[model samples]
Target chain A: MTSPVVEVSHLRKTYPAAKRGGTPKTAVADVSFQVARGEIFGILGPNGAGKTTTVECLAGLRRSDGGTVRVLGQDPQADPLLIREHVGVQLQEAALHDKITVAEALDVFGSFYSERADPAELLDLLDLTAHRHQQFGKLSGGQKQRLSIALALVGKPQVAILDELTTGLDPAARRATWELVERVRDSGVTVLLVTHFMDEAERLCDRLVVIDGGRVVAEGTPSALIEGLEGDRGVRLRFADDGARERATQLLAALAERDADVTAAVPIGDEIEVTGTRKVLFAVVQELAAADVVPDDVRTLERTLEDVFVQVTGREYRVEENEEVAA
Target chain B: MTAVETTGPVRVNHEGLRFRAFWTLFGTELRVWLREPTGVFFALIFPSLLLLGLGLAVPDFSKPMADAPPPWNEAPGITSYLPTIIALAVGTISLTTMPVQFATFREKGILKRLSTTPMPPQNLIGVHMVINVLALIVSAGAAVVGGMVVLGVPFAADPLVVLLVLVLSTTAMFSLGLLVAARAEKGQTASGLGMLIYFPSLMFSGVWVPLSVMPDWMQEIGLYLPLGAAAQGLTMGWFGNEGFPLAQVLVLAVWTLVLFPLGVKLFRWT
Candidate 1:
């Protein structure tokens, strides 16, 4: 196999405890992942899952206490200036100078690179040409996010690390940003995106590493991760009348009790859902036929990445930074 | 021009990146500073206003003092205010403006943002220092010209000594400001602390009450202070009395050497 564009091995970082005599929190412990060339790889995790810490290590903003991280075949920490030339970044909490105009920001940031992209083209791509002269503080949240993205791309970097890329954007703006990420990937710039949104990771990432408690619980393409979960794909059956519903429920309960196929069977209103191995489907049809209660629709339910995430981490998957509608 | 390659990492030749980065940052710093009403009022306009207003309006400022003692001779009050004007200009830039902006930029994550790029945070500091030095020089020139042209105050008796005093005094005051900015965790706190030192230093530096007319004990105490030493040194140079003010130069030097290092050590990029 070819070496990845970015690789991290056995990364460990511990933040000192805030209070006296308290044990220091291990922010990242033995976490490892890789990003291939031209792919939009994701690091999906909840708050305090070391997503930012891991990205910081990759960006050379933080020095890991243990393990090695290489970016483009070179150590980011040992030779950060070299890596910096090839790595563009849009930090989660950073803002440009309040009085700096959008055009001026792009112009200045572009000048920092030897291989600069056309600021005008970037402005047009991000839909920021109308606000070229607008001061950064005067721009709306969505506009600010777009301007940061423009600044990040002006260097024409080989890899762009966008942390919490669409955290504060509205649904429409979030979708637009996602499309922009896709376009960036298409243009051959590898992306390492850190996010907490389940739908976002499922939609944008070619492959992602789901981190929890500073460890990688699962890593794969979104569909593969969901399919790889050790459980039956969900099965649902709906019946018209109360009698049919009860009969369906009883049949599913018997199947679950037998433990030959179904793991758990539960009734919801006039419907029954049986969760078990793949063989549970055949078993459920046989039971229903035996009961002679085929007066409803039956279908296999597809599991979402959120469900897989919950299964792997043993915790409810929730986005820490709530999305707000831009005014 | 290198062809735009749509492949793996492009090898960039950074021949003039350093100079371009510094020059661009300096220009931006100057541009942003012009937008600051508070900074403009203090660093550029305030000193000239003091010299022009007091020199033209207050007849007593240019007149010789009454109640002359045996050893002490009467001098026009405008001469005394000169040192204070210079000190205030330096103090306002170093103490009031520098710390407030540095801490605010740090709080707003501007410094951290630059850190991720080829530009380091220290470049911001370097840019600010160079810009402020140029600004203070212009404001200082305005003060001198306004004092001489409007009030008819005599030119410096020893121009070189006056220049030395201004340089050393600015270094001392700015280093103190640097220390405040380095230590304060937030913008407001830095501003508050800077103002605390600024007001007291301004008063003792002869902004409000002339050091010449202050009570003996108070004058003695004020002479040892940074602004106090500065006012005395400049006044002595302009008047050509007490050759070189060796003590004043020593105080300013000691403060610069000590405070500048401490400021650098305590500075936090985040």
Candidate 2:
């Protein structure tokens, strides 16, 4: 087997308490993955899900308390000076000097490497030519994001680690950046991207690992992962009265028995939910009508990656507003 | 990937890489500060402006004191203010400007951005140090020449000793500034600390009262502080009356020794 360009095994990191004597919180726990050469790999997670910490450890920005990580076949922390020159990193919330112009920022960063790409080419590629002399503080949100990407690519690094790569970009700009990433990959640079955007992961990633509560909940190609989410879509039905509700419940049970695809028929409060394949909903509505029950409200929930996330992690994918762990 | 230079026992272009990296960042830093004319105002212009303002307001300041007292014998009133003006150059650049700029860069992640590459981010701090040193030199030179032509204060009676005192005093003050930059995590904290240090150090440089005229208790305290020692050293150099202010110079040297390492150790790139 060919060696992976990046490999992380049994990784763990914990942050000290925010207060003087509070208990420490683990930011990453037992995370493991490997990135093959030339692949556009991804770490997909909600805010504060240890995605950033995992990559920060890879970039040697944060030292992992346990486990091992090798990037381009060397330890990033033990040999940061050697590793730094070969890897390009775009930090999640990092900023440039407010007064520094875009062109000057590019020039200074480009000089840090022995072999660097022509910055003018990168400027044209990222569509930052017009704003070359504009101060970083004056650029629009998308412009700032593009300039940041430009700086990351300026060194012509072997692997690029981009964290939250498209947070502030407009939809069109986000798509454009995705295409740019594809081009970077085509030229044979391994990209390790961290993002919460499902469409971005599906559209760009060759393979990805889903992180939740500082652990790897799922990992695979986007389609395979979604398919492995038990391929569930739910049909929620509410009846007008208790008689109709009970009738509907029996009918769902009867239908689930006859159909091989109906995975579950469960009562959630005053409603009934039938979960299975796409055919389950059609079979369910037909059986309900045949039983002479009229439903007051009915809704269909299709399984996307977002749903897959909930299924695997057992929680909604939203910002962890109360994470004691810090930035 | 070919973009990554493969590992080998021998490294090539080490010198070329060093020179290129240094000049690129160093020159860019110089240009960035050049855009900010306010640095000139604070470092060079402030000292002379303060002197010109004070010289005009006080009539007897321009006239040398008659039958000067033992310690004040070498220092007339206006002559004392000239060295304090030079000390002002050292104080503002070191305490106010250096710490603020250093902390702002770290707060903004400018230093973090640079750290991802082969270049060490703290070299950015070195660039700032170089520029501030140059500013101190220019301002000190301007104060000495301006005192001679504008205020009729005599030139340094011992030029070599004056330069040596300026170097030692600047090292002392900037080391203190470095310590503040190392510990301060935010721009607000850096500025607050800078101002806290700047005002007291300015006073101790003895701009308002010649140390010889100050109460015994105050002089006793001021002599131990870097700025106070600097004030006395510069005045002694101006009078041509010193071998070296050994006690005062030692005080300044000790401060540089203690603070510079602590600052470098405490500084966080991010």
Candidate 3:
């Protein structure tokens, strides 16, 4: 087995309680995970979920309250100078001077490291070659995001930590960022990604940890976690009318009779959502045919990371207001 | 991962890092400051206006008193006021202009972005200090030459004493500016606070008015302030006078030692 490139054990961080007076808020509580060398490890959480604080600690930007975090086998806090040389960090709200041009910023940062990628090469890779002469303040949101990524990669670090890689990007830019991340991973650099986008996590992460209220509630490969749920399969059936909905409910009941582990039959709008195994879903479809209620739309889809997240944590995904405030 | 065997003490290549970081940031600051004529106007032009205005308004009061007074015999009024004005210009540029610049850098996360690299934080501070010190020197030279041509104030011929005074006063003011930059939370706040501290020092530190003309209690108070002592020392050195005020030099030195560490301790990158 390859050794873990990033190791965090029993990590904890606590912020001072608010002025109203209560217990101190635990930003990260007993969080632990390891990213194997050359694999992408993602941390998925809602806003105020301690994602930023956790990555800051890992990057040696903040002192950890408790627990050990080692990047490239060096203690980040104790030896930040050493770790900074090998670890590249792209903070969520990081920015540069308005008057400094993109190429100038890249060249300046490149001078800090012992070994660095050529600024021209990095600009091309990040699609920022054309905007090299543009001042940082003149760039659009997507352009700035691309510049931030270029700055992170200029040092050619062994481990790269990107926080909210595609937070405010349009769909097209988001897809481009995804491709860039995959290419980075393919180049043999370990990536620790912090994102709230479920699809992004499912697509990019080889293994992930779901964090909520400062703790890791679940951790595994996306597929493994989804499969771990008991009778976690889901079926969507759009019916003709209220009569079809009633008949679909009856069909689901018949299918549950065959499997003791079937959990729920929820009706949403004109569709009935059946949650159970592949066997139960197939039986439910046959029962619907027997009842002579032909469904208009019928499809069986695997449970997504979002579904598994909500089910395991009992909390809906919420985008916090402060997520955009940093920008 | 490849491992290398080492038998001797590990050495860090701080020279290369420091040199590279310093020049990179210095070049960036010079380019931005030059391009933004408005910023340069406010930083360099405004202070020059103040110096030329004050130098003209205050006449040679020390010369008339030179015939009667013991201390005034060697240092005349215009000669005394010249060094104080120079010191004030240095104070204005470093303490006021530099802090606001650094605060904006913090607001924009430029400093935070730099912190992620192998460059040490001291190099950033050092670059700012060096650039502002050079600006101060040029401002001082312009103020002296312009004061001579426009205000009829005579320039001192002794370059050695002028150089010594410039070195001491510049170091003292640069360290003070670092203290302000480290403490102020916002750019406007730092600029405002700098003016608040600077205006009073210019008024009571004998930059605009001689301490001898003020009440005895005011003169005693002026001796304790850093700029007041600096002005006193510069005046004594510029005119080839006796009684160099070792006590005042000691006080300024102490201020430098105390404020520099406190400034560094309080400094925030973001």
Task: Evaluate model 2: give its lDDT.
Answer: 0.82
Lowest summed lDDT across 10 adjacent residues in model 1 chain A is found at A318-327
Q: Sort every candidate by TM-score, greatest first.
A: 1, 2, 3
iRMS (Å) per candidate? 7.2, 4.8, 4.9
Which residue runs does candidate 2 get wrong by more than 4 Å?
A234-275, A281-301, A321-324, B1-13, B68-77
Best by lDDT: 1
Per-residue lDDT tens digits of candidate 3, residues A116-191? 8888888888889899999988998888988998888887888889989798899999999989988889987789
lDDT tens digits by residue: candidate 1, B13-52: 5668778877987887788779878778888889889878
User: Which candidate has the top score in DockQ?
Assistant: 2
lDDT for model 1: 0.83
TM-score of each: 0.90, 0.87, 0.85
List candidate 1 segments past 4 Å from native: A235-265, A269-272, A279-302, A318-327, B1-15, B56-59, B62-76
Model 3, C-alpha of A183: deviation from truth (Å) = 1.8
- Give the lowest summed-lDDT range of ten residues in model 3 chain A: A318-327
The sequence of per-residue lDDT tens digits that candidate 3 reaches over residues B8-68 is 1122367877687679878876786666666566556665566676655646542434563
Task: Report the lDDT tens digits of candidate 2 across residue range A3-109.
Answer: 67789999999998878999888889889999988899999988777888898888887789999988877777676676776788887664787678999989988
lDDT tens digits, residue span B110-177, model 2: 78777777777778888889889988888888877777777767677787877888899989999988
TM-score winner between candidates 1 and 2: 1
Worst 10-residue lDDT window, candidate 3 chain B: B2-11
